[model samples]
Target: MEGILNILKPPGMTSHDVVDFIRKIYNTRKVGHTGTLDPDAAGVLPVCVGGATKFVSYLVEQDKRYRFEITFGFSTDTLDKSGKIIKSGPVRFLKEKELRQVLREFEGKIKQIPPIYSAKKIKGKKLYEYAREGKIIDIPPIEVTIYNIDLVEYESPYQVLIDVKCSKGTYVRALVRDICEKLNMPGYMSMLIRTEVGAFRIEDAYTLEEIKEKKPSLQPIDKFIKLPSVHLNKIEAEKILKGQFISNRHSIETSFLKLYDNNGKFLGIGVSERNKIRPKRLL
Candidate 1:
């Protein structure tokens, strides 16, 4: 009831759809998704339950890996298969080396424009909502880092599979669009599979059917949150829990830390500032 779930979300189900399923299975209202995954794509999505929901903010910042296919025939409104085709062109296959060279330009830091039909919010209103209402808005490009990108597989003149490792908030749909532009051809994201999210891998993720039929173990919150820990005595722990700051010249130079009790039990998270530590979040 109070742990994290690494779910293998299926295509066609939005991130919130998976959260709703988990809410019923666990019978808890305090369920949340770490980040939004596109409904047309499938892959590893982390879900937090009960007290673990407090750590959702941290999980959303983790890097991610994905495998996707780009079809070089036409482009769409959504930049994916889910959208209407806006333009069509003859398929021209690029030499493997040519494509690889183009991909290198995207490695490292680059500005990327998110798809309009996405869950990105503007003033608490989702971008897709505006798009559906036939409202025109200038979508801004964001800076995202692509740690590495490689040609996974090439399938003739129509489709090619690619693997990418990127920082948080990188949109694979936009990556495909950019790659096509560099080729001077039209393309759309044909398929997408998120292979990993931080330390969570697709192979280790559970599907909804598996969860409904089997009694699987829920992973501890500490399993994913990698931070230095500080142990406190009962007296100090009580004070920290009561929103009182403890002054100490701690050797660990971190802005945040995982707090633990004398018995080695996780006490939530603490923020360190000006040589004083205060509870940032508690279970």
Candidate 2:
């Protein structure tokens, strides 16, 4: 049972909760999740089974997409609906033209300050720990990329829906807060749903119940990896097993190859640099 699972994590369950559920369902400790979906969020959470857990570091490089709602005229400690209200004010609904222009500011590379009540660690302690202790600290700004952002619709003067595509580590709650600040109104995330993560999408996701009933729903591990396969002959296979990188400079393809033995066994990953191929991982 080693492969990728498009698990539909329901709201109110932490990412760890889902992982634990899978570990029990599969009766294996090798289970792991590709990304962490917040407790209040629900959607596609890719789960790694069996040896796929070894590739988690590489999967984290993939981008994520989300659809979330923002509630204006108020702010919360946790920046979401579950948090305590810390501030409130009147919010004037901006025109569509105005909203569009405001959204434009978010596209491309931008600096973002993460919400205080977050998983970020500060001085070897989680930021949420400090937040829980009512400690305020200057959280540094981080550079992040927002590939795309579109206003889905305005649900009300106080609420609006937005779809976003961003690089890893982006916090949608913070994005909503920043947008509200730009509009001169306090804001907090009212609802969030991660529609996609990397190549996984919510539409293909299976609920926990579905997995328990359907035993063989898991896809092959290599299907989710999607790396460029490079078949190594007898001589080349030995070099890879010995932690050596061999160059295929003689060949037309110059990019990194998803290494595989002559027997078609996946041998982890490798990169081609100059005239040499360096192994990045070993199965």
Candidate 3:
């Protein structure tokens, strides 16, 4: 009951809605989701329970992978199919080579403007709040890295499917808008599915029905945390539990280490500085 659950989120349910459902299923209020996924999109969403909640911020920083479809011929106010159509035009087929070249321009680091109908904040207000009130605001662009973009399929003149690997804070809807603008065509996202986040993959995700029938097998906290490890004797483990610093004789080349006891029990996390290791968090 105190580890991570890789849940396959269903479309039309907000990320918080899934967390609430899990809370009720587990009958505990200690469950939380690592990040937010638009209600219209679906896929793998990792939920942390009990002590794992302390590491949720770490999981949020990891890279994410997504598969999405874009339909040409029009743009929407929300940059997705669920929005009002703002512009429309006839679709024109582009050569695969030309399309690939345009995608390349988005790879690596680039500046992107998020859609107005988004969760981004401005002046202590969500951007979508302003959009909902029929107000226009200048949205500033932010830098994000697109590690890779692969063309999965292209339907002549109208639809294109692609897989993208990107850093945190990337907006797939914004990406689709930019891609369409690059081609001098109007388009909007028709579908989106997050395939992966850090070490969590859709292949390992469990549906809500499956989770209800069979209790979820939680993943150990240490497995997903990519840090060097330090195994301690009972004496050292007790000291860490009391929030004490210990001498670091081993030259571990990392800022942080996953702490464990002699019997292979995960103790928690530790930070290293100047040959000294101090307890950062304890289970």
Candidate 4:
């Protein structure tokens, strides 16, 4: 009832819809998704249930990998096929050599403008909410790092597929917009598939149908957390749960460490502050 579900979210269902589905299946309102995947994009989405919900913020900060397609011909209001055709013009392409260079230019740290129809928030409200109200707002460029970007395949005259590994905030639709602008052409994201998010991969994800038909076991929360561990006796474990900082008995240097009971049951995470360990999050 408590752990993460690597869901292979199919196109058309919003990320929140998946969370609602999990809530019903597990019969617990404690479920939540780690990150938001656009309703039109399909792939790996990590949904956390029960105590695992507390770690969603941290898990969502991890880097992600995606395979997306960019079609050059027209630009859409949403920057994807679902939006209205806002701009159209004769398409042009850089030679294969020039195209690769253009993609390389996007690698590393760069400022990106997110699409107006995205979930990015502004003034404490989701951007899409403003767009739906027909309100125009200046969307600022955000600094995001693209760890790796490569031209996967280029189809004749119009479509180009790409694989990108980027920081948490990188929007693939926005990336397509920038690339098209760099090439001085009109384009929109034709397709998108999230291949990986931190340690969660598409191959290990389950569909809604599979999950409902065959209930599966949940994983331990600490399985993906990388940290040194400290095992505490009953007395020490009780002290931690009481919100009292304990002496750094093990003298661990890391800023954080995994906590466990003497019986090897995972407790949660601990913050190492001033040589004292405090319960940061407990299951």
TM-score of each: 0.96, 0.92, 0.95, 0.95
Off by over 4 Å in 3: none
Q: What shift in Å separates residue 75 of candidate 4 from its native position after superposition?
A: 0.2
Q: Report the C-alpha displacement of residue 218, candidate 3, in angstroms.
A: 0.9
Which runs in model 4 stand beyond 4 Å of their true positions?
Answer: none
Give the poorly placed runs of model 1, Cα more than 4 Å off.
Answer: none
Q: How many clashes (backbone atoms < 3 Å, residues ≥3 apart in a chain or on different chains) does model 1 have? A: 0
lDDT of 2 by residue, 85-192 (tens): 999999886898888789889999999998888888879988999998988898999889999999999966888889999999898888988998888998899888
CA lDDT, every model vs. true structure: 0.90, 0.85, 0.92, 0.90
Residues 144-247 of candidate 1: C-alpha lDDT, one tens digit per residue: 99999999888888989999999999989989999999998999999999999999999999999998888477899877898888998888799898989987
For 1-283, candidate 3 gives per-residue lDDT tens digits of 5799999999999999999988888888988898899999999999998778888876898899999999998999999989999999888878999989999999999999988999999899999999999999999999999999989999988999999999999999999999999999999999999999999999999999998999777888778988888998888888899999987866886888999988999988999888888999788
* lDDT minimum window of 10 residues, candidate 4: 215-224
Output the number of the lDDT-best candidate: 3
Ranking by lDDT: 3, 1, 4, 2
- Alpha carbon lDDT at 67, candidate 2: 95
The alpha-carbon lDDT assigned to residue 221 of candidate 3 equals: 70
Question: Best TM-score goes to which candidate?
Answer: 1
